[model samples]
Target chain A: MPNATVAGITVDRNDEGFFTDPNQWTEAMAPELARSEGIDELTDDHWRVLKFMRSEYAQKGTGPTVRVLGKTSGVSIKELYQLFPKGPAKTAAKIAGIPKPRGCI
Target chain B: MTSRIVILGGGTGGTLTANRLRRLYGADEAAITVVDQDDRHVYQPGLLFVPFGLAHTDDIVRPRARQLHEGIEFIESAIDHVDIEAGEVRLGNGVTLGYDVLVVATGARLVPEETEGLLGPAWMDSVFTFYTPEGAAALGAALATFDRGRLVVNVVDMPIKCPVAPLEFCFLADWYFTERGIRDRVQITYATPLDGAFTKPIAAAQLGGMLNARGIEIVTEFNTGEVVPGGRLTGYDGREVQFDLAVVIPLHGGATYVGRSPGLGDELDFVPTDEHTLQSKAASNIFVIGDAANVPASKAGSVTHFEGETLVDNVRRFLTGEPLEAGFDGHANCFIETGFHKALLIDFNYDTEPVPGHYPSPVGLPLLKESRLNHLGKLLFQSVYWHGLLPGRDLPGLGSNMPTAGKHLPVPEKD
Candidate 1:
């Protein structure tokens, strides 16, 4: 089976439960995921932006551009960069548990 | 650090005020921050045109933050409460933002639950509202399938956003059914809480006559109590009006956070603001605008557009320790669509109701009379709202003050 590496954290492709059911993604695993990506701590703003990005992608079937994401989330571009640091499209997509958005390379 | 200017509710009022303030103050002097729960800035007026296929849902909506200036910060969090004495705002995420001046531009919310059985099993399938984007889209679908039936457009209560919208819906529904070759199959009824077709006597007479000529039934003084699915609309007086499809304007209230803040808003959750000054009655540094304000004026976008100029000036005064200027005179203007490629324009303020005259001048756009010229003006305003109104650009001769040039004033009877 192929494994998916999101922000340096590996998840087995056979783990259908976590992918299908968002409720299964617990907070205890958040720290481990963040640590794998070399992050220290997650702020309330970070969680808020991540949750919003995930829901938007689920509904629209497309990841938002930085402009659309910032506008819809009501977060400023500078603040988004400060939280993600690796760029909003990449970092937000990774944290949101979605596949990497297209054209990021 | 620069003085913090916090504006609540990033709808029409917050977006326009933030942009106008950015234009007025330099970045070093004042820092503007706008906070809203969500970012969808729906073009409310376009909701009226949606069901008639005049506008698609995408044409009217844009991201709320896209409308603001780059210097202004945007916060997407639910407002928990306002500490007026501390001059700080509390968010649901446990973050407190301090501000020197606050603008409560939080627009009104549609309280469908307020009306009994309005959100019951038949909601969105049989009954609907066009106020929200989702509601408008659903209503568009329902309208398309409605080839023949008793199509009833009812207003659940007053103080709704865009008071003329329900009337516009009726006119457009008439036009739509006719264009679909189902006018004979459809029976259109307009139910209102007012005694006449409209609030103003002269305008009501004019509009009521037009509705009658079009064969649209008018049901006045109807205080809608419940929407019984199998039954009909049960009024408070036990009167029932049966219909195959019901388009109801549910009760509207200010933001839920307004109710949470003590002494901040009225029973309707609307803030008690001085109609002229736009200052909140609860706090000196706070001001309210748009549909959130419990002022005696039409809750329409044009009112917010007119109030934008005065509100920016008052916010500046509040910061500099100067008295607020009483400039906003309940100025509201609306383009009343009368169907069949025609619309009517009305311009007035607190001291005046809609009077028959040319707007801006004695020979400009004719008011209170249907014309194709007004319909073009209505279409032109969508662009004006995006480029001019939201960006805080001034329109020529269209100031905050209501013009009295072309109106017909009643002369006092000689003794």
Candidate 2:
């Protein structure tokens, strides 16, 4: 039930920093979240992937799979790996201010 | 009147051994009964993936009794003791079943509490092990938020199941963090008691080189003493390593019941057997497989697969009053999953160490080298276990005896 304050915004986060409630996420917090993830800035490509993840989670209630990330987000798999080095699906889900992606990576 | 073969522990070792022996001996010839404390048979290799979120517990578990062939009777109950001399096993519920041939395949037991301060303050909160399903699942949550700081994979002791598993965790961690774009923020370290990254000298050199190239630090000969505060792991000799999150493989011991069956096991309760022939030194009629056998082989599933053929062949010889064949050769192989869709495999035996070569055939999958194709093979092994291995079907090209056709054995220097 813990929450984190980032970019002057309050949002619920677990000890591991995963969102306790996905609905609490805000687009304005993405940059600060990116900074926390060690990315100083989120470029157009990063936003493209992050937006796709957030939108999919909002619509279908599940994050995008890593397999379809590059194709759907218009980013190459190689480039996607470079964009989200921790893992495209899990890391992007975290930075997008959504719940941690589930299932086998 | 049929001979009863009571296999203790319905694990990889017991399941395959029972199935293979069942196929060799019909219902009239031998009756196979597998006894275990629980009916859940876990695909232990998948435990490594659970923490990384690459696998689900449901996907890896199956009813142990269901996995057994129709002929093999499965007893889902606790084992009070094994009357090895009396040739019968007593279940916790007071039932006794005698056996002409008893296979001690209970496998290894993880003794996490054996380590100091491991089960203390930080247990499962920060110090998690992927050896068990609960541990793996707990670590999965921990790994999700673990971004920066030292992520240490420590092997507290040796002779553990899947000896290379801890090393694999380190490699996968690197991959996991690298993908998150915060790889630079996190540091990876593999602290082990062994002299190098691996046991075999040849494979160790290559694997050690890989760890070095990946910027993963290797701390050798570290005998872990305790888990101190602030994520510092102190060794017995006062050496220390710090980690924000620690993945530790605890000490292993033989099944507790082995201690009850006097003279049936080693000091650690692991059955002492011929490394070449899995026949227990305690008794000729008793055989051992997988983690149960104190053979100089890896405690991996591949070892049990290889041991199956030899075990069944020996069972036939035993029943017919023939000498057991020493064909096992301590053959063992495992696929090391590296990050970035790549994996490395190593195959070796008692005398030979894993070196650069193609496995199975000279042109087969590359050995002692990392590749994506090998990664595919690693992923494919799960289905192979369910469909082929547990059923006792021999894989084509791959057999019990290790093949040397394409293996690059180093040449000895002449004086």
Native interface contact recovery, model 2: 0.00
Clashing pairs in 2: A84-B179, A85-B178, A85-B179, A85-B180, A85-B181, A86-B179, A86-B180, A86-B181, A87-B179, A87-B180
lDDT tens digits, residues B125-205, model 1? 889898887888899988888887898889976768888889889999988888889899999999986667877767889
* DockQ, structure candidate 2: 0.01
- Candidate with best lDDT: 2
lDDT of 2 by residue, B40-136 (tens): 9899989989988899999999999888988888888888787777988888889999889888899999888777799998998889999999999
iRMS for all predictions? 26.3, 20.8
Lowest lDDT sum, 10 consecutive residues, model 2 chain B, at B406-415
Q: Model 2 compared with the native: what TM-score?
A: 0.79
RMSD of 2: 21.8
RMSD of each: 22.1, 21.8
lDDT, candidate 1, A27-91, per-residue tens? 55555555545557888987888777678767645455453455468786557767765456555
